[model samples]
Target: MGTKTALITGANSGLGLATAKALAQRSFDLVLLCRSDQKGREAQADVQKANPAVTVDYFIADLADLDSVREAAGQITAKYPQLDVLINNAGYTPARLEFVDGIEKSFYASHIGHFVLTNHLLGSLKAAGAGANGPARVISLSSAAYLGGRAARFFRKIDDLSPTFAYCDDKLANLLFARELARQTAGQGVVSYSVHPGAVRTRFGADTPGFLGKVFSLAGPLMRTPEKGAQTSVFLASAPMKSIGERNNGGYFADSAPKNTHNRDINDEKAAWLWEKTMPFV
Candidate 1:
């Protein structure tokens, strides 16, 4: 087959950048989606410097804005006829409640924005999967934090508006989104996987309030580095289809292995419901 192409969101920093580097080493042409043009260019330069033979391009899009997501997806689909992989790695965790387009900022950017982008590019992904040796992969970056919310009974309802619960709900939405995408596209050669990158030492929660921000910064020394955290994403992206197996097609994984997600509420029904409710925002 021809060379593969992978698009990664938030590819300028942290786990996204790490995954881009790993894919570049494997010779996959990369399209990086970054919010900042300068950072995107710098990241493109860095990846090209590391792998001179690989192709690296960047597209700027702010996930919090649905119009930006739509425009970016349009440009991507117009430019690339085939897309082998998409990693929804960009995330936001605000210290306080903030809304964008009538939805919570973190929830909107992390899950809804990605949901729209994936749907827009579904045609390209399917086309690539049809002609390639394996199915196209959609990897969503969820978190173990969803488990904590489940323990606290936060996911009992799908319409919680609390800022404190925004991040957890968003992660759960990511898992459900991936699973539902897999189910809806079954037998069509598009595969979706949600993953927990495991407490990476990246600047994820730096924007949160005093105690929370301090906690995120203090835990940096004890957490996994971005490279280590990107392992599971890279693994899911590059692994052979037969090796991954049908059982893991819509499953959540961590540390390069399929793992059980904590929330029992993340079924097809909830996934469908969330998708319907969030559609207007996209």
Candidate 2:
């Protein structure tokens, strides 16, 4: 196979780092988009330490910040003509209410940034699809917390952004974005998938306050380790595109398997609606 490149956001730690390491093992040259130089460098060294043969590189980009995302995306596309995998795996639970251009910070971090970044990199992804790989994959990390966000509640009541509610909405948005992206790129040799990595014990919410923080502290044994949580994402990225496509070009997965979601709210209408609303932000 020709050189395969994968770009991952929020790759400093948690599921993102686990996924990066796993992909590195698969011989993928990595480009990790992180928010800090120190963290990015540390992650770069960590991945290289684990897989010396693979080329591991890192760039700084905050998922909630537009300029940073654009600059990183440009660098990625310029560096690689073929980007085989893109895992939109960075998610944050806002410690407090915040917004970027009126969009809730949590929502921006989870969905909008990925949205813009994906759109910007579509050229490279499609280029890879047209190569020997022939079906470039975009795997986005969403949560089953989407179950908490019903269609009726999404993208409404914009002003009062509750951290919890924002989390739910963004995950819902991730699923919807994956579906819509698959729809848009159906015949272009590009496929997108949304993943629920299960409840993994990671430092993502280590700073969360109150009951949620207590849950993180006390639920260590109950949650899967980051490596264990990364199985589905790794599976989706490495699986034969034909098999994956047969199941669903844009499917939701969990437990390392493609799942058929019964949530009525997870529909094309909602997906398109989200895609429409997201255009302006980018």
Candidate 3:
């Protein structure tokens, strides 16, 4: 690849859009994925206008729909010989229990959907990693809410799911997915990391039900701006591998630093389990 490429999910707005701007500023060609085509093109133009030298492309894909994710990934891998960065940043919380292809809707949006996309693009990521600017990076956006994650094994059926609870559990799944990807791809020149982009006030959870939704809607004044929240993501996308440290592979990061947390649920065992449990879906 003449210039590095980054593929980001939910890139039409919020943290994803902000991250795309930052990466474009750093001269990376962007392949943005969004559910709405109009917003995707608008964001693409925003990034392209800001950094005229870089390429900004968009694909319309709903993470809730497995077929859509796969179709988008197919185009991406077909067009790009290698992908230098993959930001699994798309996330959403349904107001109540819902399903797409028999899986929980929020869980599908936050985890399984990205799972399929990443699986499809793994080849391109590995190709980039093994090349000159070796070790392609996979960055998943998680949240501190992961601490409250249920670890319910997302594939299982739950009679009811609160928006808040769904978010927490799915966030944990983000970390596990990253860790498992790192382990399976070890020594393959691809690295995975999960990030907690602190409570950036975005419309991401506008539809969240009840008290949590109220907090997200009213707490905008206290929350970090999208640009500020995207800093760690930009750092992870552009930093030297040595600076990130190889030991910290499959790490979780917040505030631009690796979080060596004591959370037992965020361990390799759980990561492996999640991988195995979700493999059939992919």
Candidate 4:
């Protein structure tokens, strides 16, 4: 039998690439997605070269654009029926406010695009669930910033949206979305999880403010490596974890262990409300 197949988005660099490497090391077939074709191809080559026996493929999908998301999801679904894992790891933290299709910037890329792509790939994940190994999992990356002190207070209201609190709000949306998705897919062999990778050294913060971005830029020594950053994400998707019923279905994880989420509003009702509000755009 072939090794299980796993698809990771934003796989050109950072946590996504590191996760790909970890999975390849375990002999999992890889499908890597990136916004740029050139970069995606390069990442694919790098992975394949590292593990000559593993199969690594690449797809181009700009999570910032809904059309690209849909097309990429469709392509993946058409080609692969049983996806053992789906890692929604792509993100964009723009320095300046930007909008796509009239929606806020961070909200669109971090939450809406992943939601749409996950929904589109639901059938394939379900197919994988039917196999002997039980259900397939969908792992979405959240952030410790979701509960980052007073800065988190700004994201209490989902309707009170803006560009400044864009990343914070979107991460909150990720938690809410994961909860509701777990509810909707209950007993279907498809479970959803949101995770915080901790404060890692990555290019994910290349667009932050003056000293902050610079300090984040030079964080290789002070912060965890990308492989360490990907531990919880990969574990949520592939680890033979402990009991995970509906109570923990949409649960959030950190440091490769389940942690109590500080975001109290990430319940079913809130997820449903946010879903209704953004359903039209996604």
Candidate 5:
């Protein structure tokens, strides 16, 4: 059989990089997607140095831009006949409101971009699973913050520009997408999961200049390291199908275990609404 392949967004730093390295150690070929060419090259070198026997390549695509995402997906699909795992780990939480395709920046980058990219690569994922040793998986990095309230409270509309609301909305969307994906791809040999990597000492929300930034800064010492934060993602990507539990196909996981989400209202209606509303943007 061919070597397993995993594609990771935001692989240049933080949990994304840590997950890539862990997968490399497992002998999976990697495709690191970064927004910056310089950082992408640096991360590529780091992964290569850590695992010289595995193939490590980097591609540039800013997740905030749908066009960039499509271009990158095109390139990826053209080059790789199959994709074993896709870890949507990139996210954004700006201090002030930002817009992309008229949608909130955090929502666009964290959820919308990955939504489109995953659809574009679904064929590859299915092909991989069909020919691989086991089912292929898609792991999305959501946040425990999503449990604060119902996503509809913050994400009633796609145009909501509040930074905090947008961040929460996207995290909730991540879980919704994963759940819906699993539902749609059932019996297709592809499974999906949304993961909360725990509060990790990463650059998340550090760019924000206000109370949120200060909170992330103060919480730094108390949070998990990037390596520890990546454990759930690596587990979801590499663990046995039975080990992860068939019931977890569309579930949320943290610390390598299934965790309950706060949004009890996340049902087929909400997922379908989100998918339809965000279709034009993608």
Candidate 6:
């Protein structure tokens, strides 16, 4: 049998790296996609050392830049020709608000880039096929922060992206994208799902506000380690979508279990809107 291929973005550290390690342990060949050249080199060495038998490849691309994402997708598709799994784990959170191509940073990196890359590489993922067993899978990393407690009540408007609000919007966007992707790719033998990897002790929360950032930082003692955090991502990668319910077809999971996705705006209409708006840039 041919070795299965798995590509993980931001695989240099934290949840992405941990997931890479787990996949390596499973003996799957790896394609580690990172924006940082130095970190990618270090991770290549580390993963190679740990899983000497598995072929590991590296590609560098900043997902926020559409050109970079397209280039990366073209290169990966040309080289690998067959891709079994795609984990969209790369993200950007700034201490101060930022934008890429005039859109919110979180929206650009978390949703737009991955959205385009998936489309660009859709053929390769299809080439891998479902076979008799199952199809290639795509795991998109969302965040629990989008659940917004009661604060979500005020999120009815798209213009409400004040400060941290954009992050929530983007995370919700992930769920919407996954759902539409499932519908679009149904029976094509390629599945896509979104996930909240639990609030692991990672650098993600460092840019958050006030006591929240500190509290998140201090969670090193209590929060799930990166390995534990990445289990659901791995599960989505390897598990059969049907067993997890229809929700798994285009829904959200947390900690390896199905969960109620948080937004009514995440309906088909909104997803189509996002897709149309993004088609030009992708």
Best by TM-score: 3
Off by over 4 Å in 1: 150-164
lDDT of 1 by residue, 130-225 (tens): 984458999999988776443233223334445446777778888888888898889888999999999899877877775557768888899999
lDDT of 3 by residue, 1-282 (tens): 127999998888899999999998888999999889888879989989768998888988998888888898899888987999999999887788887777778888889988888989999999999999889999999888888786764776676667787788889999899989999999998999999999898888887778779989998899999999999999999999888888988999999899975566877788898998877767
lDDT of 5 at 29: 93
Give me the runs in candidate 3 sitting further than 4 Å from their true place.
none
Cα TM-score per model = 0.92, 0.94, 0.96, 0.89, 0.94, 0.89
Better of 1 and 4 by lDDT: 1
> Between which residue pairs do clashes occur in model 5?
none
Please, what are the lDDT tens digits per residue for candidate 2 over residues 147-199?
A: 76655655454765566667777888899999999999988989989999998
Superposed Cα deviation of residue 131, candidate 4 (Å): 1.0
Per-residue alpha-carbon lDDT of candidate 4 for residues 66-137, written as tens digits (9 for 90 to 100) = 899899988999998889889988866657656665666676788888888888899999999888765888
**Local distance difference test scores for all models:** 0.84, 0.85, 0.87, 0.78, 0.85, 0.78
Residue range 8-86, candidate 5, lDDT tens digits: 9999999999999999989899999999999999999998877899999888898888899999999999998789999
Ten-residue stretch with the least lDDT total in model 6: 149-158
Q: Please state every model's RMSD to the true fold in angstroms.
A: 2.8, 1.8, 1.4, 3.3, 2.1, 3.2
Can you write out model 6's per-residue Cα lDDT over 172-276, one digit (the tens) per residue? 777777878888888897888889988787776677765556667787678888999999998887665566665467778897988886555767877677667
Query: Where does candidate 1 clash, by residue pair?
Result: none
- lDDT for model 1, on a 0 to 1 scale? 0.84
In model 2, the Cα lDDT at residue 102 comes to 66
Q: Highest lDDT: which candidate? A: 3
Ranking by TM-score: 3, 2, 5, 1, 6, 4
The residue-level lDDT of candidate 3 at 164 comes to 80
Q: Which stretches of candidate 4 lie over 4 Å from their true place?
A: 148-164, 210-220, 243-247
